[model samples]
Target: MAKKTNKYIKPFKNIFVFILLMFVVWMLFFDANSWLIHHELNSDIEDLEAEKEFYKNEIIKDKKAIKELSTEEGVEKLAREKYYMKQENEEIFIIEYQDSLPKNKEK
Candidate 1:
């Protein structure tokens, strides 16, 4: 009876050790927090890439605008519209809208 019991105990102990090792591996490598962190990193990388693309497009637009403004006619048009400069004897009239009022209105 003792010999038979000893034989069965060894196999049961081996199986228990194997199960414990598997549980440790799963917790370290396949747990919920690990997966969540990996997913968040991927999403952050995607967002940064989108922002980089937006800035790249903005740079292209700015370069084109600069090229246009370097020309004589484009410079004249910008000055007239932005600075309100006109030809001699031309009058400048300013229009004010309620929605366009300054932030601080003292009255």
Candidate 2:
């Protein structure tokens, strides 16, 4: 009979090292607070932070608009432009050219 030796099997022969490796693997992948779970949570936090920044910018813009509309002229301009309101003696006429109309996709 010939004697056989394998270099790879030497370390795992120690019971303590094998158990330590198994514990590390379990903590990294199988535990409730695993590395994979933490990575997902971090990504979610990044998304929420970006969303918070966007809302903050929107609030600033809204505050500026509110300040502008605090005066009578700004309110009237907004009403006339957006809501198509006019003074009692004035008439509003809206003209649409061929290019200004929305094209139909059904054709």
Candidate 3:
């Protein structure tokens, strides 16, 4: 009986020690804060990459616009639309939107 009990107890002790060691290792290296921080850093890196891609596309668009503006026709069209420039005798009219009024009656 004593031998049988000793054999069973020995196995249980080994299992308990293994579990304890694993728990210690997990607490030291795989805690909640470490996982959270890693996830946050990953998200931040993803956001930065997206921002970089957006800027890259914006640079391409700006380069294309610059190339277009370097030509005479493109410059004249831009001036006509943006600056409202016209021929010497042309008149300019300004129109205001009704939505530009304040929402509050008191104001």
| Sort order, lDDT high to low | 2, 1, 3
Residue 17 error, candidate 3, Å: 3.7
Worst 10 residues of 2 by lDDT: 2-11
Which tens-of-lDDT digit does each residue in 10-90 have in candidate 3? 754787887987887786568875656788889999999999999999999999999999999999999988998988998
Candidate achieving higher TM-score, 2 or 3? 2
lDDT of 1 at 13: 70
What clash pairs does model 2 have?
none
Q: List model 1 lDDT by residue over 1-107, tens digit each.
A: 54455764676578787798788778767887676678888999999999999999999999998998999999989988899898898888989898897778677
Q: Please, what is the TM-score per model? A: 0.56, 0.89, 0.57
Which window of ten consecutive residues has the lowest lDDT sum in model 1?
A: 1-10
lDDT of 1: 0.85
Give Cα-based local distance difference scores for all models. 0.85, 0.96, 0.85
Q: Ten-residue segment with the worst summed lDDT in candidate 3? A: 1-10
Candidate 2: residue 83 lDDT (0-100): 98
Most TM-score-accurate candidate: 2
